[model samples]
Target: MKKIIGVDLGGTTTKFAILNEAGEIEQKWSISTDIEREGINIVPNIIDSINQQLSQSGLSSTDVLGIGMGSPGSVDIDKGTVIGAYNLNWKTLQQVKEQIEAGTSIPFYIDNDANVAALGEQWKGAGEGNANVVFITLGTGVGGGVVAEGKLVHGAGTAGEIGHMNVDPNGYECTCGNVGCLETVASATGVVHLAQDYAEGYAGDSELKGLIDQKQEITAKIVFDQAKKRDPLAKKVVDKFSFYLGLACGNIANILSPNAIVIGGGVSAAGDVLVDGVREYFEKYAFPPVKTSTEIKLAQLGNDAGVIGAGSLVKMSR
Candidate 1:
């Protein structure tokens, strides 16, 4: 039976999975990313882990179709190079393909982490059977990917950067050195920021206010939990977060008009609360045609989206 390896490379850990052509995970595991030497050992470490897994499974090189990987930072897919993955201390373009191929002697395909996640969702998760879709991940920072006309759109190798979409020119500054990017208002950090800002002037009684009084750090989960309980301040924070997220989605709808907008990541764990709230605003801000055409939903793949999407990359290339 032919199998493929799916790799989700993150700043701290790298997840690996073996999948058959049917997209079922036969086995999966992970290893801590070795970034001690400017990430020089990252690729080598990945190769070693792969070899170990293959040996343990009694699988040979010929039985494997290829390897697919999802990595952070800008990627030159054609060259299999990472332009810059700052979190991994990769400041220069690294020859990810050549290095990994040299080690494993298998063809490798790579893409931006967000893009692969979107691909994964489209293949077997929330966007399954849909050719046109957009995936937004609201984690520590926002990330986005777009699949248009049954293909991943990578115009100039920088397509689907939904998080950087300018939402508020005068709003909070984003880590991307921009003011009020969608990430600043719709991500996990953004939610907490909104909660803190709302608490400053809120005189009403709320659990968030008590946390503030106690100098306890507030999180997006806390805000969502409080809002579900009808805490006024937390509700306000959620309302603001949803508004910006919806506005961004509306803009995307106007531009791409995909079949569905799939939401994922840590913040999305809030489930219906987050999806329903964003849909409300998306409908309000989007054009009528776009509003009715696009469906908003949560991603079903969870952490597996990355690995499955990576595996899909190999299948797509074949």
Candidate 2:
């Protein structure tokens, strides 16, 4: 039974999984990223961990077919080099790859984590069987990926950056150095900021305000809980959040014309309130064909998508 190692590296935590050739996850594990201490040390440590995992089952490095990884940054897939990840504080993937290969013989593959997640959905999750799909991850900030013509679009490191797309010229400033980027009003940070702004005059009796200890520490989850409890301020905040989110989705749909759009990430935990709102706004704003043709669905793989997608890419690249 040939198996591939999937490693999904994040700023806080890195997830690992052993996936079979048929797309089944046979085993999984996790660990803190801790890349800030010595970013170059991650590769060898990861290799040791994978070997340790296989040892438990009387398996050796030879039993593993390949390694696939998803990280945060621009990756040159053709060269297996990660240009640099602002979040990971790493400049190259080749060094990381060389370190791992020095201890192990299996070939390794890598890509941007968002692109990996999109590939995961397309290959084995929500967008399974679809040739084209887009994944939008709404977390502290927005991240997105596009899969078209049965492939993840890699337009010279410029692909899958929809979050930076400007949705409002007169809106809030985005950390990406853009004014009114879509993420400014649609991500978790955006949602919380919107909630706080809306809670200005109604700060006294607002359920959201009551739930948090300090008014300055309110979160999008807090607003979501309040909305679930029927708080008017929360509802207004969510409505605005969804409106912008949907507008962004509609624009992506109109431009890309993907078969489906998959939504994921932490903010997606809000469930129906978040999804329904986006759907409503999407239908209203998208062009007729786009509105009726493209289906929007929630991602099913959750945290495992990155690793699975990364590992799967190894097989595809072969």
Candidate 3:
């Protein structure tokens, strides 16, 4: 059976996998991303990794169909170039596809990291068998992808940026230099910021307050844990977080009207607590038809979403 290579590149590490057309991973591993020298080393490192894996598995380049990759920032998919990946300190466009293809003599396909994750879910996870869906990732930052009418919406190569949707006019400024973006209130960092703001003024007793008083770092998990215990401050923060998240989902629903919204990333590990809270608000703010039509659920693929989605790209092309 023909196999394909899938790569999920991040600021800190890059995940690599070998998978068959069925989307089952045969081998998977990761390596630290060397962003030194304007990320010039990234492609070479990936090529070396792929070759090493192939050697260990006693496979050859001819045994693979192609390679698919997910990366951060805007991508010129048609041109096979990355417009920009700020987190990787890639300040300028990079010829990622060309470099990889040249190194391995194999074809390469690429897309934004979030978009590929969405495609992954659509192929084999929560969105299995569904053509239209939205995939949202709530990690240190928020990222989103949308598929409409059985097609991924590239929208001039910058579509599916759900994180930047202005949800708060007077909210905190986002790293993207936007004010009150959905990412500012719903991302992991946003959750911690909300908890910190509440803990500062809270005179009442709460574990969140204790964490603040002890000068310990506050995290979304800590807030959720306290909220589960019914701590007033944590509950308030979680409620606010859920409300903002719901409002964002409602807005997306009104715009795209996708069949399902799949939530993923590290923060999503909170599971039902997070999904239930967001759903409560999503139903309230969504348009009448949207509220009834869209099914909000957790991402089933977890960390594998990126690679699986990338691998599926090869299948999609055929």
TM-score of each: 0.96, 0.91, 0.93
- Kindly list the per-residue Cα lDDT of model 3 for residues 1-318, writing each as its tens digit: 999999999999999999988888989999999999888898899999998889899998999999999998788787788866887889888998898999888889998899999999998899998889999999988988888887888886678778898888999999998799988888898999998888888999887899888999888998888888998899999999999989989989888888899999888988898899999999999999999899899999998999999997777777
What tens digits encode model 1's per-residue C-alpha lDDT throughout 35-142?
A: 887888898999999988898889878889999999998888999999789878898889999998998888999999999999999988999989999999999989
Candidate rank order under lDDT: 1, 3, 2
Model 2 C-alpha lDDT per residue in residues 99-171, reported as the tens digit of each score: 6666777788888888999999888988998988999998887898899988789887678887888878888
lDDT value, candidate 1, whole model: 0.92
Error of 3 at 116 (Å): 1.1
In model 3, how many backbone clashes occur? 0
Candidate with best TM-score: 1
Clashing pairs in 2: none
lDDT of model 2, residue 274:
81
The list of candidate 1 runs beyond 4 A from truth reads: none
lDDT of 2: 0.83
For model 1, state the Cα shift of residue 268 in Å: 1.0
